[model samples]
Every structure is written in structure tokens, then in C-alpha cells.
Target: MSASTPIARSKSAALARILDNVPKGYHRYTCGTVAARKAEALAQKFHTLYGIGCSPAQRLIRKGKGLANVVLVMHWPVDAEKVEWLLLATDGKGLETETLRDVGDKQRLKWLGYELARHTNRAKVMWTWRRTKEEMTELHALIAMQANQHNTAAISETLERIARQPGFRGVRTQSWALCEAALQRGYDGPLPHLYFVQKTNHGERLALD
Candidate 1:
């Protein structure tokens, strides 16, 4: 495919975002046994050429399809927020990694599956299936704060800060979605920027392998 192709452009955009968010020397882990092996295999394939290494965990399935719903465990270096990825470098070969930085465009799509892995990064996972109670409570709080005409920047900042706290991570993402859903139900209140909100289309389902 040509470099200017649409798919190439999409991959380039996605790859840029992934590379930017994924810290140097940090790798990702895919949760679950089967998903983990797939991630490991992908990482092993390009480990010799690229230093990126993703590892897998020995857990069972949780949600989504195949690797889609497998929670991603990111392993961060000290001083960085921790996350995990699958496709681990073999023992003693810590240098070998599963990165897309230097991989070709064709090969890039293969690793895109990693994106489906359950991720804590707000940019990756938009809706949180866990912690619904906390999320709902926070959602109402944010709406109330917005009604009080809090500074949009402060409101956004608060959302970010709160989302990072234990038991509240991804609350911001879900908040936006919930607010949107509320609006659809004929509620009115000051709301944060609604640009990032996403919703599931009716009848859509994850393709099972």
C-alpha cells in the first residue's frame, strides 16, 4: 500500500499516539493466558529488530472478544505511572521489546490488536464497566459542579485528577458518556466539553473469534 493511503494514514496516526503515550523502556502486558501468548508471539517476531517488548499474563478471559477485553497490565519503570503489556521479552532478554516505532506499515496493523487489550489509559478505554456506582456518583457531582458554573478548565482538571485516584480511574471518560446519555434523555445542565464522548451503536457486538 502507498504511504498516502487512508489506512496508512490511520495507522500512522494511531502509531504516533501509541508511541507518544507509551513511555520509553516501558512495555505492555495483555491479561489472560490465550491473549498473552498472542501478544508474546507478536513481540517476539520483531524483538530482534526493534527493542519494544510486550509481555502476556497467565490469567483467564474477563470481557470483550479474544484479546479485545483482556485487561492490559502496563509495566512502568520506577518514577513512571505503572501499566502492563503482554508479549514479554524472554528471560534475560529484557532488551528485546515489542515496539512499533520502527516497524513497517504492513506489520503495524498486526500490533493494532494490542489496542484492543483492556487499558487503563483514558485515551485507550473510554467507558469503564467496573465501578459503576462510583462513576455514577462522580458523574452527578461533575454535573452539579458544572451547574455551579465552575471554570471549564478547572472542571476538566478536576475530572482528570479524580479519574487518576484509586477506584475512580476512567471516571472522566464515563462521565462524558453518561452526561451525553443524560442529555439524550431530556436533562439539562452545564456540562463539560462533550467532544470526547462516545456511545455504542445499537446491536453492535464484539466479533468473537
Candidate 2:
């Protein structure tokens, strides 16, 4: 499906209207004395990269992801090259400044791949949870049972199986660990850091600083 379909158009139009009404070059708001700047930096970066103006409504949608309250609809050109260009531009700060050793790069790429895979699996798990909650519970219990029987290998195998199950798509073990670690550390917002850890043969962990 096209990214800028009718629904996307409506969302974009709403965001555009919000932006137009705001004072030029002023992108901050106050709910109380608690005032915070809008995501002007991110918006400006996006605009510079994609040649599209971003409005407060768009910023709200992005910020809402942290709150887990609102559904965001972002539109971009359907072409793969353009999509890559936008992503590359938006992601440049992380990829360029981050110092990743060879091993760390491999680990990070593995984690990224797993994350992508896990998104697909999550859909299945969600569908199963909705349609047959009891079955889903039992499935998880069975997997946990298998995981408990063995050591690290068993744990990894169990997780992989669960991930490969129909509807349980997306990244495997290390990715989940990274996500859990981030969440536990109070990363309730966008992924601000672009670092990953790699374990060495000497049982030491190296940070992709």
C-alpha cells in the first residue's frame, strides 16, 4: 500500500494546519510552568532531509509514541531510494558518531536484524492473544518449561522457537535482551543511544562507545 494514502493525507493535512497556525520559528509550548521545546530539532532535521515541513501535530504524534497513547501516521515517498535517503539522513547522527568496533558492529547488526524479525512475530502473538488467550498462555508456559529444562542453549533454543512460531515473528534472543535492558533502564522514549555490547572470549564485555 502507498504510504500517503487517503488516511495518511488526512493526517498530514491536520499536521500541516497545526504548523501553519503556529508563530513562525517559534516551536515551544507550555502546559503549566512546565514548558518544553517542541521537537524542533528533529522536525527541522526531517524537513532538511526530506524537503517536507513538519508541524506540531506531527511532533505530537512522535512524542505520543513515548506515552504509548496515540497512533502515529507518518507519510513518505513510496520509492525505496527516497525512503533510504530519509532514514539515512535521520539516522546519520547515530551511525556516524558512534564508535563501534568490528565485533560490536556485528553484534549490533545481529540485534537490529532480530528486532526487525520480532516485529512480525509480535503481530502473531498479539493475534493469538486476542483470539485464544488461554492457548497463548499455554504456549508460553510450554516454552518456558522447555527453557527451564536446559541451560543457556536451551534458553536460546526456546526463544528461537517461540519467535519462529506462526504470528510470533521478529528478532530473536539478543534483540529482546537489548530491548529489555533499555526498558529497564527507563528508556521510555525514542531510542536515543546507538550503542551495543559485545562479549569477548575472555568473558569481558566491550561497549560500542
Candidate 3:
């Protein structure tokens, strides 16, 4: 039987071990608006330290846990639609966490870990579709490299770029729409400012001037 939660020294570190097994395709959508820069920054740190492409979408861990906990907010890579936000957490053990948001027909976290499957509750039906690996790879390369080169003014150009992809079929889901919005939301800081905080010992975001 899997433990109810993680029991690793660092939740982020433990999660890195499970990301490869989450069953997501190439990570194309990364980087978010000013509101999400903190998460993106932390996601880069996780990638650097653990090699798993993860970002914190929502970091609302209540106060008081004798253990280190990290909530990684992200979308399932396999789902090209990006309909829902997948919240993954880590603990003192392995990758054990509860999904924060599930707004789609299928719950794809079965690959995260057994503990997560049990804890993942609620699923709101949303857009569903299938995408090719080539599409995903192209999007990732285009968006990631020019992440800071988009804004409300360049929305047309950005959309055009995505639409011009080899097999671009167009956005089919609200999740994909939201993901596009984030891409064009523009960068708030010169560089991403990662935030690592606990309710008890909450810390300010690390933004370079």
C-alpha cells in the first residue's frame, strides 16, 4: 500500500522523481503572466535541480507542517488542450499529492502515482482532444524561445505563429485559449521571480531589479 502522502526530505525533490512518470508529452506551454511568474521561476529551479519540467500554479499550503511541502501547479503535458490545472505536491516520502483543480472529462494523473489517484477528487467536464507530438514540440520551441516577446499588442502575431505550424488545426478547447492568453500576457519582470514560501515562514518573491 502506498503511503497516504509523500515522506521525502524535500517535496520538490521528491516530485522531480515522479514527473518523468506523469505521462505527459513534450512541455510546450511554460511561462505565465505576472501573476504566475513566481510559479514559472520555481518551475525552472525544479527543472534545474531535479530535471522535471514543473511549475507552481497555486501555492496555498496552510500553516504548520513539520515537513517540507511543495505544490507544483501545472497542466498535464499529454493533454494538448491544457484544459485544467494539475496541482502536484510533495512530502517526506515519495510523490504523494492531491490535485487542486480537475475541470475536464478525464483525470490524467493516474500516471503521477497511486497516492495521487486516490486523493484526486472532482472532475468538471471540459474540452477534450488529441494532438500530435510534432505539434507539441513545435509549439514548445516557438513559445519558450520567444516567451518575453509577446504582449497584448502582439497577440495577432503570436496567434499567427501558432496557427502557422505545420499541422496547426487551431485551438479547440477553452484550456488552450487560456494557455494562449498567458503566453501573450507579457513578462512583468526582467526575469522570472520564483517564490518559495510557507504559511508560517512565508517569504517575499525573488525578483531581480
- By lDDT, the best candidate is 1
Whole-model lDDT, candidate 3? Answer: 0.32
User: lDDT of candidate 1 vs native?
Assistant: 0.33
TM-score of 2: 0.20
Residue lDDT tens for model 1, 122-192: 57542122234544676666756664664455455554454443222243456566556445544453555
- Give one digit per residue, the lDDT tens place, for model 2 in 43-154: 3443443323334465456444531111111222223221111121121122332232221122222111121111234454211011133444554555455435534444
Model 2 RMSD vs true structure: 20.8
Poorly placed runs, candidate 1 (over 4 Å): 1-78, 81-83, 86-133, 141-173, 177-191, 195-209
Task: Give the lowest summed-lDDT range of ten residues in model 2.
Answer: 109-118
lDDT of 3 at 98: 24
Q: What is the C-alpha lDDT of each candidate?
A: 0.33, 0.28, 0.32
Candidate 3: which pairs clash?
6-92, 6-93, 7-92, 7-93, 8-92, 8-93, 57-73
Models ranked on lDDT: 1, 3, 2
Winner on TM-score between 1 and 2 is: 1
Give per-candidate clash totals: 26, 8, 7
- Maximum-TM-score candidate: 1
Ranking by TM-score: 1, 3, 2
